[model samples]
Target chain A: MATTLHVTLAGNPNVGKSTLFNSMVSGKSRISNHPGITAESVDGFRDRDKDRLLVTDLPGTYSLHLDLPEAKLCRQHLDQDVEFAMLIIVIDAMGLRRNFQLFSELTQLEIPMAAVVTKSHEAQLRGYQIDLELLEEQLGIPVIGAAERSDVRSLEIDDLIDGARIPAQIPAQGQSIEQWGTDLLAKVSKPVHPEQARRRRLRDDRLDRLLIHPILGLTLFLVAMTLLFGSVFWIAQYPMEWIDALFGKLGVWISSRMDEGALRGLLVDGVIGGVSGTLVFLPQIVTLFFLVSLLEETGYMARAAFVADRWLRPFGLPGQAFVPLLSSHACAIPGILCSRLIPDRRDRLATILVAPFLSCSARLPVYILLVGILFPDRPIAAGAAFIGCYLLGAVAAVGTAGLVRRTLLPGRSLPMVLELPPYRIPSVKEALRIAFDRGMSFLTNAGTVILLICIALWWLSNYPSTPAGAEVTALRESAAMQSDPIEANSLLERARSLELRESAQASYAGRLGRWVEPVLAPVGADWQLSVAVLASFAAREVFVSSLNVMVGVGQDLEDPTSMARIRGSKRDDGSALLPPASAAGLLVFYVLAMQCLPTLAVTRKETGGLRWALLQLTWMTAVAWILGTATRSVMMAMGFSG
Target chain B: MSDFPIEDPQFWIVTLLSISAVILLLWSRNSSKKRDQGGSCGGCKPK
Candidate 1:
């Protein structure tokens, strides 16, 4: 007695399929700027006339016959034994011929269908008028013209739903699908006059000339990236500081309320410390995602990819590889997952193998820590050094890709071909939504993983607890005797710091670090650094917290004074713990090392074999160690002391 | 107060977190394997 209709919204990539889906469903589904952003079908429902119409947004694919995973997914969903009331194929009006080709193929399914032509406004702006009635007649289906507006409810989509209720008749045509598509286009659409066409072309060409020009485009790209990274460093500082202070206060509060015991140590030093280290990077992650979303929405990402393609092709990477590589800067998992869009298997593999070389947000805290130590007074130098690390990673990725292409996956690089979507002003609301989603997902997903690791590490370093020695007791006793309040507080702080450091040295992690010190010594790592590096294998950002735990600095690195104290920390031999050479070496190592277990698990799963993952780990670790050792030697030879 | 001195608040918190971590890890691994078997794009095929 209940009427529920199943409908699918399908279309070519970047033809406003997601936008229409969002508008129709009222932002019920995820929408982003890039083509193939939705790799899986998302379902939403609407109530119409006492009946429910369930709309499913399928992944964008160029053709049902294409071998790619997205194409197969589209085909699989379409072939599923569900009684569909209608299939509304969304097409871009500006690109009718190519879009119609898909519609012609869809006709073979023999399902009740309607066609919705989006981007009509863009077409009209270019002086072209599409006859939806003629298109309806030619295709024997209801054709609706939907302008690119935010309000999908205004587009009379209900008429489309109603029209789709009627089964479409497949017209018997002598021509093939391609010919039918061309014939239908010729009959139903008229292009702008020659002069008007020239004018539109001129406008597009003028913009393209600047955006895709060799020297100017590259320069603009560099400038844009510099500003982006600069803002990431500058803007994220405030929120990062707030988070650090909040966590610090929480730790102090807990310490005050609880008596000194294993429970107190675990709460203040283990749990809070670990969570704070990773959470502190949230502001930068949010900023990066927000800005990247804006760029993707503005249609600039396509042009930037186009430019990068020209430069990267000789390095054996196609332009299409640029998106995944760029996305890797956020996190390599999504970046590797996004590689499904690349048509060629070899190119995709190379992209996946080398993507982790890009310095992800996980590395941000480590970079800040070491850079802060290396450049205590020079913020400008620190910023430049930060940018330099990203560049180093990117260069290493491209170089590695080139080598792989030449040796293992030997083949000529595929020539890049891409469609540059019409430029539009980015929507702030959409960008903010995407940024929030990404930030939350990062916090929830990576946060859980990091939190567990942190607790485990805390337990590792805390248990088999060491008792306070004679010197620590003496310092506490002396602090109690000091009459001046300031002096007394300083002495108390000293006693606390001494006790923490002593306990840290006696911990299991400290013992392991001491065991591995000789092996890491040539790379300028002390026992503490060795412990931190070893612990960081679980996750790169863990290095900061592990180091904090090892050095008894507590968990708040956001405070300038705390960071300064960390920078001034010395080894047992009273030598500077992080000299410029050693810091540079560590930075290089972190940049190149395949230290993330999650990334390896993802790689093994993505590449469909542990072989590639093993190769990636072995190759990256070797490269990182060799390069790091060289950097240390070179810096030391140059007399660059801390 | 009670005979079970080690079963304090800190003990419970750490225990809860560790148990949650183990459950999450197992759930994630199982789900990832299922996704792979289902031919979802998220995971690689077993060679």
Candidate 2:
């Protein structure tokens, strides 16, 4: 029979506990639940000599007192009274004091255990002194230092497996161990019980002057945020452009080889043009997520949350909402997933409801397209406008969260009892893996949703034919533009005119747009714009194709000149709607809109009712309509007609 | 009555000055608070 040692891996959040699990068992288990639960129990098998050990990776938690879901799970798992050879408590060496709190409580469980101090390399560099034997004496457990570059601890763990047991009483010579353990607990005494461990580590009064000094700290935070946003946009732009060019060239090359047909059109426009156009933004997404992962891993993000907590409090949200909201910038899927950490149901719900407003990777394409259309000549200006839109999304999210909490789902702010894990230099490998996982998740999970929306939009704008004369004229112009290099303008114009003449009277999408046109007409949206808005309801990115279809651009897999036609298209009376300010408004609208059907579905699934999702849809749509109307009205008043 | 351009140099100078000032003030406040707490609790029994 195999030795079933029920070992639990417990540590503070982001203390390289997951990485250690990966290294130990060579497994990549997501180990999550749908409606969100504490760390779902994960089991891994490891064989040393003849004994096979079963290791369970418990969720990283601050303490074992049954506070959070994961902590409760950990406590419940231990209560089963299954005999464990040893409970291997892993602690970051630099964070020994904080790590010891949990360790001390675990010892109180009176389980046979051994301590493995991690990140010895960092401890050595930081000039932090820790005596392993002394700690062992203090905790009445065998203690060993572990480093990624070393395997001695693995050997120690294996050796201890057979012999490790909770001794009821030790020889009198081990009396010093009890004293040291008592002394360690005495070190953290403070007048106020809660937030003591955190405040002491931060040296609260000093940090508050710089971090929450009302005026100074707030100003610093704002400055830091502006720079963070500006840098993400400016620095990532070069790589983003290279990716765009690469995709564009590949698209052009692929289109050149195929004969005009539906298959060719689907291959070129639907899959490559639609999917890759969105996918080319992966590098930017990866970079942003990578930076976020690093910030989170390093513990500065906790400080940021602490700083923002006061501001966040007004929205009936805890400071813990900040990191999850910030994480949404990469994508809301993970952000919604991370909201599980917020223990309080109401806070988590509010956080999830508002999270999609933090412009995700899905909205990036819509923003880029609008920027390209509106400010073709000013790339830098367009980038700034894009950043501004992100800010708008964040502001809208926070503001709306406040309104919703007050009016609809009134709730109290959750208790803020987060543990601030000591700052450690983020492992590049760990950060990269996290970034890759997130980026790939977008392609796999969210990408499927996007593709379905695209195909549906393609069908919407394609069917219902024009009259024969108009169709012939459209085909001739498309072919002329494709064959001739310079007549692209005429071809594009012909396509646009054809769309204007026939779309509303013909295609299902066009008909739908015209039907809804009256509703949005007061908002200055034409039928074509109305069509785009309707498509955007499927997803924000669908707005581009909806527009492409409205222009009668060869959205058909057979139509090779579709893109060129789209570029040169104009509205009635030869006015371009793709100018900068208009694009900015569109970008703002997409950023603020609850436009993705899949996100709505997921929100409904997460909140367990249509009530929250319905509220989300109504609020986001109302806000988008108001903001878009105001933007267009103001621009028109400034004599800039769309 | 507004700085129209908000020159980059001026922005950086203001940012650095504000940040350093905040840090210094925070350090001082933290030191004082720590002292106050330490003094008050010095003679008290351990929990």
Candidate 3:
């Protein structure tokens, strides 16, 4: 029987402990330049010569003094986890003074440990050449040098594992942590090329002036974000279309092969449609993670956080919340996941809570539809309203974030103490691995739930069948007598339209729509619009299709005549289907509502509770309703006619 | 062939499979919920 060797990798934030752990176990824990991106502990195993090494990588922490989330988690693992056969103190050679304090604190645990110095090459280049043999002698434990920028496989990891022993001396207990760090720092940091060290510091300082400047830095950050998200949307477009077409063809093929029945319709429209709806967004998700991965690997992501911190701090969000908030513009699933970068539990939760308020790409089609209705003829005005929709969502996200921090969270954002990593040429291979891992993770978690929900919704919309009514029967009879084929086809289409309308009105989902109709009346909506609004909880983009179906419009949402048909329709009370005020209000609602089930699912998963997900839903829905109603009331008072 | 969908064997088979799929999903979700030690956004930050 092979014995198990319980090993752990521990370090300060940004010390590249994860990279070394990956090397040790050939594991794929996502690595980033941002501090504490590993918000959780994970284990990996390796087999060596009749023994199996179970390696746990603990979340990195800078201090035990603060009640920070990462620090608390790390403390719990070290104190309470299974007795370690070995603890690897992974410290950075480049910033030994800064990183060594955590090492000092861990010595109190008195576990068997060895030291591995990371960023060795970076230190040497800047003139600090750490002598591993001398330090190994001083600490009386095995030590090795590992450079993160190098091929980590070249590390003699097996030897390091075999050499683990309880150190003869722990970092001195009496002196302050900083003083101890500096005292040890003098013993090392031997000047190899002292002049180069000055030059290196000078270079970094000069770069920092522009990159993290208050005004210029923020501008650069925004520009970089625009380019990043722009590319995500633009580049993912082709693959998205391909996925759409592929699924469409698959549905058609399934429909042809299956026998005519409700089962076939369910498979084609419910199952396949649901899967495709989720899968079609995969390209956008992949692209967003890919570009962000590249930025993170290049080390600019840390700097970007610093640049955002100045503006975000006043709003009770840390700089780390910037990436997640901006990412929400693409999709809230990854945005909520990215909240792991944040250190405080409350700040992270607040970011996750308000992230869905931002208008994700899912809202774009709804915007184009409603904004088009609001300003039909004036192209410039339509374009401005489209831009205004995006701005409104952004304002809502920030405002909600501030409100949440003050009330539910009840604290200003913890002040940021940042350590900007030196920028490097990003590795495409590493970026691709990070992006792929995140993409697969998304598919496994959010996609499955979305598919199931879509199926359920599809079933709700179709079941308890409504038989053909009087108008539908009359139209069919008229079509039968028409002599010309074209005229016959027109009559058949009219009959189909009436049947759809009747069925939509009588279906369970339709009944739910009617149930909510009175509540939505103040927002300038009747039963049909209420049904669309209710169905959109599945996904905001579904609003356009749901409304179209409820009013008996054709499948082609982009068709001008279909849009015109929607505009020309009326309510049961004989009022216009969507007056100018109502359209404006609906636009506002789509911009602010928590309408994506996938996002809520991810929020629950990320926050580790159903309470947060429910809170996010309640708060955003209430905000959207109040604002939507306000918009309609103001517009109505302004005398906007149908 | 049966006149009604419910009477058809093939219809019943497909319906059974769909219902089973939903049950399996619920079962899987409940199982994972129990297994969760509860604090990771799926990895990278130390537990």
Candidate 4:
């Protein structure tokens, strides 16, 4: 029989539980849903001195009295019928009393657990004295102090593999019994969980002032947000450039080596170019995640949430909704997942309903393209416009949610009572580890999706035959005749004109675009632009690539001239079509549309019905159409011409 | 086929390498603060 020792790494959020888990189990991380919950569970393994130990990294929770899915799962996993040889409770050494609360609960759990005191090096620097033995005796569990350099983890697991049991649970502290259970039980249960006792003594008076004292808390909130922005902007440039260079070099190298053909185009222009364009942003994503993980790990996130509660209440959201909303800024998947924190079904629904408005990173490409084309010299204006769009989306989302609540579904706000976990210095190792993993996932997984889409778009745009092919070939040869002649270049460009060359009549995307043109005509859309908009319904970033392909131009998103050409093109009669008002209208249309397929997939799964997801699509699309038409009319009235 | 944006790819590569070093440095400083403050309560929750 294979003897496997089960060791659980537990701690409050931001206490470096995941880091220690990673240290124990290198390269075996798996994100799995818990046995019966929608929340994600991370599990892994490690080998110590020829013995195998299975490690489970439970979500961060303040106590066993869990209301949130993350906390509930943590508590549920602990009570599981499966036998565990030993439980290793990871405590942020800097947060002794607060960590002790959870430690006390674990003791009451009657599971064999030992305190693995983390951030030991910090204790030395801060001149904090720890009576290790006293802490061990007080909790009736073995206490081990370890920091980044400490490597006794393998040995500790070896001991567990050798059937080591956490010294028996120290009975609960007596002082806290009356508050939780009964005074009668308090007499017999001398020390109710020390955590309860600590919680009683923990002064919310000081924290409450800084956390909820509307004025100061809001200021601190602004400062934190500023720092986050600083990190995202200031720190990410080098890595972004590096990624760009890497992909550009790879594209150039591949294109050079391969014959000039469809395969080469697919590899260089489509795959490398598109994927690298997106993946370059991964460093920024990781940096954002790192800051958030650090804040969350060190316990400031809860306080931030707590502080923002009163302000968020009137908006039909609680303070906790802020984190998920903030997360939505990076991507909607995690934001949607984080909504599980909102216990009230109505609030969660509202959050889900409005979440798409948070301006996801996918929109970044489109935003960048538009900003570059229209506002190239004014980066600040571009950024301000970007922020304005986010604000607009948020405002719209809130208004729509309020409307939905009153008419479609109505419910009262869930009372806000959140645990304020004590602050601890976040483990840097843990932050980096999370940042690395999440960053890698974005690069490898999401990058692949974007890459495949780009390649498909490239293929569609460059495939099959047009009867004008002979004329185009002759033009190409004639252009080559005088390689350096400017007039020859213009003539070759004429060969690529949008003349009623008839070939586009058979191409798949063109046919589909035309088929949908009738439905879009009222909304001021031509078949080519309509196809781009429809493709964008799959993903906002796909808009540029799809449009680029539809126009038979390469995917050079930064090229203003290419966009101008597409914008300047006309119908067979040579009538002007992509007018200023209509172009701005289409831009506004995409701006308001909830057109991401992944978001829809996630919404369906999260809401547990296709009904809500379809409703989301219908409502958002309707909103987009109405708003787009109104905007176009307004712009036209303002003397904008097509 | 377009001319590379930077005058020297290697130079930019080295610059990125150095920037990564700087990031690691900053990350270490932050980690050290957490390490040094380890063990025993200072009466404040880990924020």
Per-residue lDDT of model 4, residues A1-642, tens digit only: 556777877777656665466667764332211111123456676665555678787767777786777778787788776664568877765455556557657766666677666655544433444556666655555676675323434436444334334554334455563243233222322233456435533644466667667789867876676556455645765676676677666766786798755556556654565555456556666786688777766657667666656666666775556666656665565667667777788888888877777677666555544543444445445555555566667677777777877777686676566555545567678678667876675554434345455655554544343446567678777878876789797776767663223444445556777899887665557777787777665556666555544543321223222334344456444554467567656656666788776678778888999998998888888887888788778978899763
Give each candidate's interface RMSD in Å.
8.7, 26.0, 7.5, 17.1
A428-530 in candidate 2: lDDT tens per residue?
A: 7756876676577556523554454444444454444454355646666576758665576666656655553553345566678779977775455656777
Model 3, residue A442: distance off in Å is: 3.9
What is candidate 1's lDDT per residue for A1-642, written digit by digit as tens? Answer: 558888899898867776677666645444545565554677776777767877888888778888888888888888987864579998888788787656766877888888888778667656676898898777777888776545444687877778773434333556566666677767877766758666766877788999999999989987787777667777787887788778778877887899976667666666676677667778877887788778877778889888888888998986778767776776676677767778888988999999989888778778887876777656556777888898899899999999999998887677767778666678787678677866775576445656666666676665445677788789889988989989988887777766666666676777788899887776778888898899887667778776655554322223322344356667876677899899988888888998787788878988899999999999999898899889999998999863
Task: Give the lowest summed-lDDT range of ten residues in model 3 chain A.
Answer: A553-562
Better by lDDT, candidate 3 or 2: 3
Superposition error at A212 for model 4 (Å): 6.3
DockQ of each: 0.15, 0.01, 0.17, 0.02
Q: Over the full model, what C-alpha lDDT does candidate 1 score relative to the true structure?
A: 0.73
iRMS of candidate 2, one decimal?
Answer: 26.0
Best by lDDT: 1
Regions more than 4 Å wrong, model 1: A1-9, A17-32, A36-59, A67-73, A83-86, A114-116, A121-163, A166-171, A175-200, A341-344, A372-383, A445-447, A469-496, A516-525, A548-579, B1-47
Among the numbered candidates, top DockQ falls to: 3
Please give the range of 10 consecutive residues that has the lowest summed lDDT in model 4 chain A: A29-38
Fnat per candidate, as a fraction, reads 0.07, 0.00, 0.03, 0.00
Score each candidate by Cα lDDT: 0.73, 0.60, 0.69, 0.59
Please state the Cα-based DockQ of model 4 relative to the true two-chain complex. Answer: 0.02
